[model samples]
Target: MEVHAHTHTPRKKWTHYFWEFLMLFLAVFCGFLAEYQLEHKIEKDKEKQYIHGLLEDLHEDTGTLSETINEFDGHLKRNDTLIKLLTSDAIKEHGSDLYYLGRRASRSVRLALHDFTIQQMKSSGGFRLIRNQKVSKAIIEYYNRTVFIDYLNGIESNESDEYRKMAIDIFHPVTFNGIVNPDNTIARPENNPPLLTYDSKTLLRLAGMVSYIRNTKQGLMKAEIEMKMAAIELIQLIKAEYHLN
Candidate 1:
């Protein structure tokens, strides 16, 4: 009987197994690297989007602040004239002017800041995406000042309200209504207008409120100016940092 000898298959070399292990390791490492790069790009893109939104809000804030500042400045000029009339014996002579100013004593010009982006960042933990420490701090400081201006705004409204309350005591509602034109401008009275009272103490007390209102406005102006400067600086800073237009 012829029997076939057992044939043995050759064992794989150590180098061949090493090459296979190396290939598997490289494939896994390459996939991990690709995933990491994708995540990094995503984070960077998200950061730019936040920055763009913030820039828009800031630009809007600057424009609004400018308008508010100018309006308040003009309003303060009128208050100065009002203070002049109310503090002197001349006020009785300028009855038309007195009632004209009195009607607008409580006019409040408010500035509602564009805070949409800032609020979103704060609420959603998006500030962390603003990686630069200096830029972040500047942004925070600019917004912080707005809060102070807002507080002052409340005081301004309160002062104006107090002045209006005083007006009720001394002002003639009919005369005030008569002075207003269709355009909300005040025309000089056709005849001498009369107030409710001529008591010096009461007149002076009403005059005192003008000073308070003026002081509040002055405070608001200073804060508004500071905030505007801050806004400008922040815009420049972010542009420089992020290379934004």
Candidate 2:
């Protein structure tokens, strides 16, 4: 029998094969780690952009709010001037011009307030979030009452005492009776004796409207400032969370 020489190359050692397998595994793992890091960076960048955009939107909204407040303040100042003019002897004696001016000022104030209310609604999704329903309802009722006065003013003559009382009612709707304990029920003008009975019903209604406006203004201002602060805080949180700086 011829001696058959098996001249196959010696198989690699088990140790060498083990090392080669480990090297291949490590390479794949390294590639996977690099891909994961790249994807993570991309995601983070997208989030950063989103936060920056939101911050910009908040800033714009804040600006709009500030502008609205400024306009409202101006309207209030003008209304104050008109009130002074209405009370003056010269305007009262002269009659028609001052009466018209006063009426116009009152109308202007109400219109400005309406615009402000609309803006507030847009900014905060209505007063319900910042103020209680009772307060909001009071405000709406006051506005309706004022609108009624406006309607009456259009037809009624200014020289009548009824009109003068109505104007006073528009200005001073609330009166303080004896101060009471917190537990006691508050006394309002309607419950108290009427100072002017000729048009007491009309005057009382107008007084209530004015009182409602005054009370709601303070609450609205506080609520507005709080809303601004909340918006600013949210913006800061977004900046920090997304590393938007």
Candidate 3:
């Protein structure tokens, strides 16, 4: 009679088992969400580093351009002084050596200016924001046209007195019979003025243009730098937000 009175334990409810399964599923989903967020943040940080490196390269190129322009400007000023010396009556009476030196100086200045113009045009396309090939080509063409006119008008060299007069006539026309006429009927080298023999004015104009180009280059460099800084700041903000520095 005592053996037949064994008690039966209560079986676990199916509803309780279902609840435990749901809790385990929720825990796994939460872990997956956290992992996805961590991976996304890591990818963003890597991209920011890549952009910062590009900006550094642009800064270096801009610095090189600035140095080249400065050196060229110094050369131009020195040439100007040599020109003044050559034009002096004392130097003229001394010998042809001073005149030859003046001619060499003028030639050097012209070549240096041309090189600077070409280099600037090329460098303009290297920037991130200003790297438009079409625009750069247009600018180069315009400069080349102006330089051609300058050279044809005898502005390239101070070697020939005859050529200098021709350049002056092209710049300033004379009046004849109430009409403004070029000094030479055929625009030949034989008929021209003496004042047009030096390249001081053309050099001055080129120098001004160079300054403008330099400013534009600097602006582009600054913009690129700012862009990189902003990206870095955003990365720091995200790291702070997620506490993943």
Candidate 4:
């Protein structure tokens, strides 16, 4: 066997190695930047989606609150009328009118807050995605107020319950039935409200009912006003933060 001389290839220069390293580093850096941009875009989109959902919820809440406010205003007026009638001698002759007034006052208008979006944010810990600190704070404050409103609503419901109990004690069930026909129309039967006047005990019950209605009405009115103001403020904040009209 003949021995051949082996020629070894030259090692790469350091500059060559450095250029290769630089190229690899540049490529990786570009890819990382692209990925970061994509992630940022996704986060921004998610934030906007949350904001839009919150806007819808706030709008719904405001609308419902307006309707509820109007309904409670009517309730307040009816209760006021009942209070006046109860204090007058005419109530002895027209006890049927008290039935109408009591029926209105006894109704509880539950204000349902639109909290689907907020609840989701809270449960999922998505509130961190909101970049605007003001928006986050406003949302928190609004929900907090809602909690108070709910407590007030509970008190109002209790008052309404008491009023209903008073109604059961003072008015005959059969007589109340006489006020509404089977067709659901307003009607006054001859035997409606079998009694026209209340004794001392019943009058005392009426007085208590009137006092409760007044207190409930006042508390509800204040709560409604505050709720409306909060809603309006939140709406404005959302609009400003989201650049919405």
Most accurate candidate by lDDT: 1
Off by over 4 Å in 2: 1-9, 71-198, 229-245
Model 2 per-residue lDDT tens digits across residues 119-199 = 444475543332234433533443344354344333332223334456654332333223222665332223323232224
lDDT of each: 0.86, 0.45, 0.41, 0.78
TM-score of each: 0.84, 0.43, 0.29, 0.85
Angstrom error of the Cα, residue 219, model 1: value is 0.3
Sort the predicted structures by lDDT, highest score first.
1, 4, 2, 3
- By TM-score: ranked, best first: 4, 1, 2, 3
**Among all candidates shown, the one with the greatest TM-score:** 4
* Predicted candidate 1 versus true structure: per-residue lDDT over 1-245, tens digit per residue: 99999999999999999999999999999999999999988878888988999899989999999999998898788888887887787667888787777776667778888989888888988888889999999998888897888899889888888888889889888877777899977766666687899888898898789889888898999899889999999999999999877
Q: Residue 17 of candidate 2: its Cα lDDT?
A: 89
- Candidate 3: segments with Cα more than 4 A from true spot: 1-28, 31-35, 75-79, 82-245
What is the number of backbone collisions in each predicted candidate, taken in the order shown?
0, 0, 0, 0
Q: State which candidate, 3 or 4, has the greater TM-score.
A: 4
